[model samples]
Target: MISSFLLPLLLWSIERILKRKQFGWFIVIVTLSLVNNFYFAYYQLLTGLIYFLLELFFVINTIFYQEKVQSNVLSLPHYWH
Candidate 1:
């Protein structure tokens, strides 16, 4: 039930993080994942742990990829129009 509500917000955060390179959106995603872990922990500890780990992995990879992309862009020579 609550997951449904959070899904869109999570997607939005991912989009914003990728598009704007804002660290705040990444923090929001982490917060949301933690909240989800707590919410599911009451019912199933193993499931919650698995979900949290997966989310963490995804967020970390996204951050690393964003950093790599930004570095690559900065290294490229720019031409004045």
Candidate 2:
């Protein structure tokens, strides 16, 4: 239960310290943790699954939208006086 809350924060801290994006770690850790929850009680498994999906959606959306914005900016023409 505690791991579910802490892993994201741990990943975020690692990314921040390294000054690099770490989506791969985020996906793997979250997926495994959620999958492990299924071995426990039913309620924990259900809530963990829901939370994992929501977090995955949010992370994926942020990555896609951020890339889209970056691409648009890069494609814009530069002006010189």
**Lowest summed lDDT over 10 consecutive residues: which window, candidate 1?**
40-49
- How many steric clashes does model 1 contain? 0
The Cα local distance difference test for each model comes to: 0.61, 0.59
Model 1: lDDT to the true structure: 0.61
lDDT of 2: 0.59
RMSD of each: 8.9, 7.6
Q: Where is model 1 more than 4 Å wrong at Cα?
A: 1-43, 78-81
- Report the number of the highest-lDDT candidate: 1
Best by TM-score: 2
User: What shift in Å separates residue 81 of candidate 1 from its native position after superposition?
Assistant: 14
lDDT of 1 by residue, 1-81 (tens): 565555455555655655576668656655765677765423343444455567678989999999999988887766332
